[model samples]
Target: MPVVWSAVGAVVFPNVGGWLGGLITVRNIKPWYESLVLPKWRPPNSAFGPVWTVLYSSMGYASYLVWRDGGGFDGPARLPLILYGTQLILNWAWTPIFFGAHNLALSLADIGLLWINVAACGYSFYHINHTAGLIMLPYLAWLTLASALNYCVYRDNSTKIKEVKKDE
Candidate 1:
């Protein structure tokens, strides 16, 4: 049925972002990331995978609810869906920028945009489906925390960041 496919698509979409992020982050966790001057507030690296898994799955399910209730993909739901897609891309970009490129400043900027996109997407989703909007709240919260973490790293490791940037 169409509903089933929509649900599947919803879940799969963010997972694609997750998968791409994993490709960049998994290898870097040991040496590169561990060496960083992370904040005291930072969660353990082990916490990230499980948290993201739940967030991505919930995001997909929320999108599915929006799609199903907003008259399907081709109907009035287009704007919110587009916003969601945009945020998803931004979400995917952050990990690579941070871990792969080791550009904390750029990563912070990227996540700032991501935060805006997520808020807009949540707002748009709220108009289409209330519960759908609610689902995005956790993601928004996480982004807030991530933005802070990124800022801290950038600030605390400015000299190192400069060296890394200069090397590139």
Candidate 2:
């Protein structure tokens, strides 16, 4: 039972950061986001919740495995943990920027950094524990798709003086 709880905690903790961010400002997101020209490849709105749930669970399990392996304090394993923490922070920041503050440009920048950090983490994880690293691969791939989507949103919505002038 204790192990089960710990496993559950492992999946939930890292994801809570994003969940909290989204919950805080979910109401403000639709106005700005709905007006944008999203890429055709954008997944259905229904896809995000379930996908993230699974991804975060895998991430948490990976964290638990790394921590339990006695590699948390020091080892090559520590590198991925550190990278994971960094990326998680960046991940949480994106929702507030895109949704709460309505700064899609900043969100795009954050997502770009998140993409890089995930890559770094993935590489580090591979060298430490292959399974732990493999667990993160889906997350990396999803983020890659997300980053492209974010880039498109930013490019399409950027405030151009020419467009403003034309509107006037």
| Number of the top-ranking candidate, with lDDT as the measure | 1
Model 2 sits at a Cα RMSD from the real structure of 2.9
Those runs of model 1 whose alpha carbons end farther than 4 Å from true positions after fitting are 164-168
User: Model 1 TM-score?
Assistant: 0.93
TM-score of each: 0.93, 0.86
The lDDT of each candidate is 0.89, 0.79
Candidate 2 least-lDDT 10 residues? 157-166
Residue-level lDDT tens digits of model 2 in 1-168? 987797788888977886787585557657656766778889987687778878888988887777666357576467778888898889888888877766767898899999899888877777776787899999999998888888887787776523654797
lDDT of 1 at 94: 90
RMSD of 1: 1.6
The true-versus-predicted C-alpha distance at residue 120 of model 1, in Å, is: 0.8
Clashing residue pairs for model 1: none
- Full-model lDDT, candidate 1: 0.89
